[model samples]
Target: MDTDRLPGCYRHPDRDTGITCTRCERPICPECMISASVGFQCPECVRAGSGTGHHPTANAPRTIAGGVVAADPHLVTKILIGINVLMFFVALSDPVLARELALYGLYRDYFGGTLHGVSTGEYYRLLTSAFLHTEWWHIAGNMLALWVIGGPLEAALGRVRYLAVFLLSGLGGSALVYLLTEPNVATLGASGAVFGLLGATVVLAKRLRYEMRPVITMVVLMLVLTFVPLGGSLSVSWQAHVGGLITGALVGLGMLMPAAGRNRALVQWGTCGVAFLLAAMVIALRTAELT
Candidate 1:
C-alpha cells in the first residue's frame, strides 16, 4: 500500500493519515484516534464501544461549530479587549505612533512628511488600525460593544472560528474604506470587529430558535445611525460598518448553517477564506487605483 496514497481522516479530510481504526478501518487524524485494547480506534468506535453507554455526543464536548470546548470561553475576547486597550494607551502617550497605525490610503502629516498607506505597501495598518483609538469615547464604546457581543459569540463559534470571523470582518471594513473613502481620510477603531460579533449574534439567535425581533431591531438602529452625520469633526464611516456587518453575517451562516455529521469545520473555515479573498481583492484593486 502506498502510504502517500492513503486516504485522509474521516473526520478531517484535509489531514492525511495512514492510521485507521482497528475495528472500523476508517482513517482518522491524531486528534480523533483513541487507543483501544489492541490498536487505535476512531472517536465514533470508542463512543460506540463505551461500557458506560452514554450517547456519542454526550461523551464528547464540542462547540456549535464542532471545536473542543475550552475551559475559558471568553479568553480570546478578553485578550482582544486587552490588546485594544493597551494600544489605546500607547497611542495616547505617543501620538505619532497612532498616526502611523491608522488606516489611510495615503496622506501627508502636519509635519509635511509623506506617510505611506496600503497604496504604498504599509499594509499592516489594515489590521493594526482595528486595535488603535485616540479618543476615550471611541475605545470605550467599541470595547463595551465587543464584551457584550463577543462573549456569547466566542462561546458559540469557538476561539478559532470566532477569531477568524473577527479578523476577516476587520479586514473587510478596511478594504471597503480604502476602496470608497478619500485617500487622505484616516479611519481607526474596532467598530468593524464589534459589528461582526453583532452580525454573528443574530445568526446564532436564529439558529437556536431564539426570538429575532430584538436582534433585527438593534441591527437596524445601528445601521441607521451610521448614516446620520455628527456635526463638527466627529463622523462615522458607514462604509466600514456596512462592510463588517455583511462579512460577519456571511461567515456566521457558513459556520452555523451546516448539518451535523457533515464537514462542518471545513465549510466554516472555507467561508472565512472566501471572505478574506474578497477583502484582499478589494485591497489590491484600491491599491492599484491609489498608487
Candidate 2:
C-alpha cells in the first residue's frame, strides 16, 4: 500500500502500479487508466460515472442521442398575421395596391386593374399574392387557419422551417396556377400557404400517431367544393390548393427522414434546406415547361 512499494495493478496482478482511479481509488496501470478532468479514472469508474448509460472506449468521445431544444414563442406566425393585417389596412386606403400585388394567371397581365390590365411580367406576384386578400372574410379565414396551423408547426419544426414551408408551398401554389389556368385570370390570397399547413398537418398527424381521417375528410370535401363549378360567379383557385398540399407533404416526409449529423439542430436545418431546394426545383421545372 506504500508508494515506495506500490501494489500490483488489479487488472494485471503481475504488474506493479502507483496510479489509482480518481473516482473509486482503485490501483490501475497506465494501460487501463482513462484521463479525466480531475485525475485518471479506471474503465469501470468511467462507465459508472456517466449517468446516461453511454459507454466510451479509449480515445473515443461520448455519444448523445438528444440535444437542447429551442424555445419557440410562435413569433413567426404572429408576425406574418400582423403583416397581413397591416397590408389589409393599407389596401383599404388605396385599392390599387391590392391589384398590384395580386397574382395574374397570365404572365402578360401586369397592369393596375383587375385582370384586364397590360401584362408586365411581374414574377414577384407569385409570392406577393399570398400576402394579399380580397375581402374582410377572406383575410379572417386565412388568419384563423394560420393561427391554428402555424403555432404547432413552429413548435414542432422551429421558426425557420415553418417559414420555409409556408413560402415554398406558396411558391408551389403560384407555380401551379401559372402552369394550368388561363393567363387572363387573377388570383389573390394566402389559401396556398394555409393549404400547405393542412398538408403538413396530415403528415404530422401520421407521425404523431393520431387519427387523421377527419382532417383528410375535410380536405377532400374542400377539394370537391373548390373544383366543382357552382352555378354562381364565385371563383376559387384550386390549383394553389393542390400545389401547396403536394409540396407540404413532400417537405414533411423529408422531416421524417433520419437526420445525418452529430448536431441534431444542424441536421434538422439541413433537412429543411433540402426540402426547400426540392420545392424550388419543382418550380423551376414548371417554369421551364411554361417557357
- Predictions in order: lDDT: 0.81, 0.67
Off by over 4 Å in 1: 1-58, 109-115, 229-234
How does model 2 score by TM-score? Answer: 0.64
Pick out the ten consecutive residues of candidate 2 with the lowest summed lDDT.
60-69
Error of 2 at 32 (Å): 43
lDDT of 2 at 263: 60
Q: Worst ten-residue run, lDDT, model 1?
A: 30-39
* Model 1 lDDT tens row, 110-211: 677866887989999999998988887778888998998898788767788889889988988888888999988889989887887788878877875554
Number of colliding residue pairs in each model:
0, 6
lDDT of 2 by residue, 1-291 (tens): 454555766887764556677678888653455555445666677667675555543323111111111334377889999988988888778877777777764443346743332134467888988898767877887899899877666555555667777887888787787767666677877888878877876776565444467679978886787786644322678999898888777766555333323464565556567756765665566456544
Q: What TM-score should be assigned to candidate 1? A: 0.78
- Candidates in order, TM-scores: namely 0.78, 0.64
